[model samples]
Target: MDFSIILMIIGIVCVVVSFFLKDSSKKIEKDLEELSISIYQETNSLKRRLKVVEEELLLEPNFQVKSPLPNKTKSSINQSFQLKQTEAAPAKNVKPINEILVRQVIELKKQGYTLQEMIKMSPLSEEQIRYILTNNGGIQ
Candidate 1:
């Protein structure tokens, strides 16, 4: 009779422990879901803030975002920064070489120029001319 009582007690303890564990597991899952949602929202907020800062940077004319080393002299920094500014300025005015070359290649292709002739007249390589012709729905 004492043995039977001990078995019943063990069974009751197991059932109570299982219910407690199940409830705690559900609470843990709810907390994790809340944390995941919070992180996703924060990430999107950071992305929006970054886009605003980038737009502001682009709008400012004299704001040079320099990446000079901490130990660099001011004169050296000025020289390097000026060089970058000058190089970046001209890029806005000139058309890309590829766009110009593609137009020239299209004209040459229309004129029945051979591949070798097109390659000789333009700075583009033979492969580049062929690629442009093939991809632009021009002659083979």
Candidate 2:
């Protein structure tokens, strides 16, 4: 009445399945020996084939490793003593106003100056200072 009969039936079924599983596995051990021999022969043959291919490849000329200088004529390259001058781009010495202002603020702040003192040293007005400091998330 307490499901003990059902549990015992399930246990017997599991035991029967385990016995069948064990009996079935005895056949595979014989087959595994044959499988092992076949696997060994396959591996040995593959190794021999790979060795022959490697030896053949070693005999051939490796074209990729050749020096490219022999193909290019020496006269085609610049031989004249004229110094190779890189065209100088006239540099724009301009920096963003806000960046310069931020750098000045950080530098002045690092030097133990208050935010107002840094603002005073900067060329920007009170309004510009407020905006940059606020954007940069400085004091207020």
**TM-scores for candidates 1 onward, in order:** 0.36, 0.27
* Candidate 1 lDDT for residue 49: 100
Tell me the deviation in Å of residue 2 in model 1: 4.0
The TM-score that candidate 2 achieves is: 0.27
Tens-place lDDT digits, model 2, residues 1-140: 65999999999999988876756556788789899999999999999999998776454422223323332321212111111111222343222233334445656665788667866798765544554445444431
Looking at model 1, residue 83 earns an lDDT score of 57
lDDT of 2 at 7: 95
Taking the tens digit of each residue's C-alpha lDDT, what string does model 1 give over 1-140? 99999999999999988876757777999999999999999999999999999887555433433423232332343344445445767454322223435566878889989899998999865655665676553422
RMSD of 2: 23.4
lDDT of 1: 0.64
Q: Cα lDDT of all candidates, in order?
A: 0.64, 0.53
Residue 6's lDDT in candidate 2: 93
Backbone steric clashes in candidate 2, count: 0
lDDT of residue 38 for candidate 2: 99
Model 2 stretches with alpha carbons more than 4 Å out: 1-26, 62-140
